[model samples]
Target: MTEEREPGFQEPIEYEEECENCEVRVAAICQSCGMPMNSAADYGGGNEDNNCCVHCCCEDGSLKSYEEVHQSMISLFMKTRGLDKERAEQAARDYMATMPAWIGR
Candidate 1:
């Protein structure tokens, strides 16, 4: 018999096949930045095992500090989105607040 989910519940995506460049299976999104991590190249340090994206990790394959990620996101918003410093900071905070890594803090 098929199982039924609760109201407003969503099924988790299950990745069964291994990625071409790494042993880890593809995940739905980066836990840190919410970026799609469909391919090995899209994962941090090019490893599909990472829960975060390349931008959210250091070259050594560790997750970046919260401040570092916050600053980078602010800078990115200011540069690419043409937001001013204050607005960029707010935008970054709002975005990061929704991410798993920064949800409570």
Candidate 2:
């Protein structure tokens, strides 16, 4: 019998924070937007936010969602950050692929 293959992996959040009360929170520090989302569905469910919430939401933090990542954040970077349309997109894509967001201690 053929072996089953594993699904693609998405980077996990490096910087999640919560109150002493144990409330879950995503630290929304996009270097663009300051409002982080508390849940994964904040950023329309993609890599738009990456680290910062309300930017993107991973269905289950799976990295296979790269396309969703690119679509969600590309426009925002160029528009808000005044980055060149092409370069901003490339950078955002790169960040999503390589750099996992910083999680709180």
Candidate 3:
């Protein structure tokens, strides 16, 4: 059996605004550094303009270049895993290749 509502009666709809830049609608980790941020100003390093976290930006809020982030990650990986420079670079390149273009080459 089915029940029907009045002709003019309609249920309300819900909507959520996600980040406009990184395409991440939900508050989550930074795409580059794994830091947490969202669209809120108080927490998660959220920035509504470019849709990125605070640490990922310069003082002016411009996003850091992809190469910078990639190099940092590679260095971190090398230091933590004890990988040689050549091996770390290749591994980092391979890993970044599987990520979205936003993560860079």
Give the Cα lDDT of each candidate: 0.76, 0.51, 0.55
lDDT (10s digit) by residue, model 3, range 1-105: 878643433232112346668764554544445444544551223445444456556656666777776687689879999998888887776765543335334
lDDT of 1 by residue, 33-92 (tens): 677777777777887777788989988668999999999998999999999999999999
**Which segments of model 2 are wrong by more than 4 Å?**
1-35, 39-55, 58-64, 101-105
Pick the TM-score winner: 1
Residue 49 Cα positional deviation in candidate 2, in Å, after optimal superposition: 17
Top candidate, metric lDDT: 1
Q: Model 2 over residues 1-105: C-alpha lDDT tens digits?
A: 975533332334345656678786655454223344445465434454464444444355333344565665778688888888788888776655543431110
In TM-score terms, candidate 2 sits at: 0.41
Worst 10 residues of 1 by lDDT: 6-15
Per-structure clash totals for the candidates: 0, 14, 1
Candidate 1 Cα outliers beyond 4 Å, as residue runs: 1-27
* TM-scores, each model vs. reference: 0.70, 0.41, 0.48
